[model samples]
Target: MNYRKATEKDLTAIVKMMADDVLGKKKEKFQSPLPIEYVKAFQNINEDKNQELIVLENEKLEVIGTLQISYIQYISYLGGMRAQIENVFIRADQRGLGIGKKVFKWAINRAKEKNAHLVQLTSNKERPRSIKFYENLGFKATHEGMKLHF
Candidate 1:
């Protein structure tokens, strides 16, 4: 597997993978030529030095997974940098292939390369299996995660 920064050309596949799950199906508008909002958001993330939108490709160079890591510099943790992982998704057909673990290992190493103090990610409560996967990856639910949607 190869991991690299996502390009505009990979947007459709990325969105498609994101929408493959039940939670994503409720939120993502995965259509051909996707909503302009996705394009605009991609532009913003692409332009930001601290934001990394990544795509995982197989040996044949087919995109099969996607995730975004945002490096945030904060005054806490002794003025450290934190890597926040988000929007992780693997193509439906690609599940159970251990691809998720490989991608996460890559992401963690990347965080280390960037001098981040820690790497963190949040999965929806609706996905128990995902939470367990993270736990298996050595992530601890050290704190309760709360969200307020507008």
Candidate 2:
């Protein structure tokens, strides 16, 4: 698998992968031709210097995995930057092939290159498997993550 920063053209494929999962299937809209908002959101993320939306591709250049990393500078980390990983997804058909590990490793390295002191992410409470996956990657479950959805 190969990884690179995502282009506008990769947005649809990325969204499709996001929607392929159990939780996402329920939340993501999959209209006949999809929606333009996905592209618009990609544009906004792309323009943000703090955000890096990336994709993993096969040798044929078919996008198979994607994630977004946002670098944030905050006083809480001693005025250092932290990387927040989000929207992580790999093709369901492509799971267990070590693709997710590769993608994560790349993200961590990228964060280090950006001078981030730490990398963080939040997984939904419903995904025990994913939580374990993250734990195996050496992430601590020290903090209780909470969110209020509008």
Taking the tens digit of each residue's C-alpha lDDT, what string does model 1 give over 1-150? 888999999999999998888998899999987999999999999999999999999989999999999999999989999999999889999999898998899999999999999999998898999999999999999999888999
Clashing pairs in 1: none
- Residue 124's lDDT in candidate 2: 90
Error of 1 at 134 (Å): 0.5
- lDDT, candidate 1, at 60: 93
Query: CA lDDT, every prediction?
Result: 0.94, 0.90
Tell me how far the alpha carbon of residue 55 in candidate 1 is from the true structure, in angstroms, after superposition: 0.4
- Please state the error at residue 140 of candidate 2 in Å: 0.4
TM-score of each: 0.97, 0.95
Model 2: lDDT equals 0.90
